[model samples]
Target: MIWKEARNLYVNKWILFEAIEAYSEDGKRIVKDLSVINAYDDGKEALKEYREKHKKDKSREMYVYHTKNDELIIEERMWMGVRKNG
Candidate 1:
């Protein structure tokens, strides 16, 4: 479902979702299609779930968001760090 649809379905709640179809434009992550993983009353719970899922699968584009947001405008940031090779 789209962000708007998700927002409508899960009103006034925190949700953990996977971005199935998305793109970056003007330093923003625009999610076109997504799948809702779970809903929560608290943002922290959603974030916790997102972290666990992300840790298990780094490839998946997952996020925690509140349905109160009118737009799903995620700011994209470049990760700047040196990684030591194992």
Candidate 2:
């Protein structure tokens, strides 16, 4: 019901944010951006405000995707011929 603080990482930086499912004027699915409440965003206070804002929209969905420095899964083929021989 409430917009939880959603966090993601980009370029090794933590990007804390929140989103509430909303339909644009033309009825297009969209996510409304809420300001970052805390530095790392604990999602406590922000969720409260988001619920209050779109209380009537029962169909709306709040999504939170957690990321930390972002772990990258790399394959050996990606490195091509630059890898050192062991």
Best-performing candidate as measured by lDDT: 1
lDDT of 2 by residue, 1-86 (tens): 22332334222223333443344443343445544333324445445655664476655443323334232211222234675689
Please give the lDDT score at residue 75 for candidate 2: 21
The per-prediction tally of clashing pairs is 0, 0
lDDT (Cα, tens digit) per residue for candidate 1, span 1-86:
99999999999999999999999999999999999999999999998988898999999999898999999989999999999999
> Which segments of model 1 are wrong by more than 4 Å?
83-86
Q: Model 2, stretches more than 4 Å misplaced? A: 1-40, 69-86
